[model samples]
Target: MTTLHTPRLTLRPITPDDLPRVLTYRNDPEVARYQAWALPATLDSVAGLVSDQPLGAPGWVQRAVTLRDGTVLGDVALNTQGPQAEVGVTLARSAQGHGYAHEALHALITHAFTDLGLHRVHASIDPRNTPVAVLLTRLGFRHEGTSLQSYRHRSEWTDDALYAVLAAEWTA
Candidate 1:
């Protein structure tokens, strides 16, 4: 299992014990607003999602983002495909505006490029999520493009923005 540490946070593989906390934040309307997860996430469903995939397996892996004192803030998710990967992060409502997401994502991206030797990492986010767009920009990801009304989300056609960073472009 990969465990990464930032100055104030730790990114570790998600475990069974984190299901409830993950469920709680995942079900939060605000937190789920731009996320792709089904609504009303249950503990059993969360467990099934987190436990089915082993950490070093060939698909998605989730990491728990916690404070140094062991408080669960949220999670960072990476879906790897050969030398490239897609990434996402979620923070509890109370954890927003605290820079924890930035810190956690930095650690994850650095690990992806430096330790995992990924060629590229990217994210596709709802265009409406300005905060995430800014966060990605701050992390040195370039805005590749936006797909207009490419998919139906929450009963409406929504635009998706793609942002990416290459291993050679990553600074840390």
Candidate 2:
């Protein structure tokens, strides 16, 4: 039961009701362009995709990104069990360019570095996602490396850019 509040958004666990909201953007080709998952995410499959969170567990937890009034804006995921937690974010088209994603992710990453005592926090994003790459750079995450043809999306091989921030370097 983790709920993090930023100035304009709240990050909490996913519920069945959130599937439709998530599916809307998740199914959008423009939004899912550089993401790994396939398009047209079905309700049944998405409903069961909700994570119970279960912190300290060995996998990822998808959290709902919402407004104070509970309007779903997008979602974020954190792979909580590793030495360096990995994070990913998806925001509705309407919510983009508003800093909501940065706000939500900053809170979660702050927790990962401080409360969770993780040594580092990282993300592997498609190189084509320039916006996210810029966002990560602006957040002080170092561009660690790039792996070519490391990820398969649809039927094509894509390059991945690895960005990370060390706990010792996390000023926030």
TM-score between candidate 2 and the true structure: 0.94
Positional deviation of 168 in candidate 1, in angstroms? Answer: 0.8
Q: Which residue pairs collide, candidate 1?
A: none
* Candidate whose lDDT is highest: 1
Candidate 2 contains a number of clashing pairs equal to 0
Q: lDDT tens digits, residues 68-101, model 1? A: 9988899988888999999999999999999999
- What is the TM-score of each predicted model, taking all chains together? 0.94, 0.94
Clashes of each: 0, 0
- Which segments of model 2 are wrong by more than 4 Å? 54-56
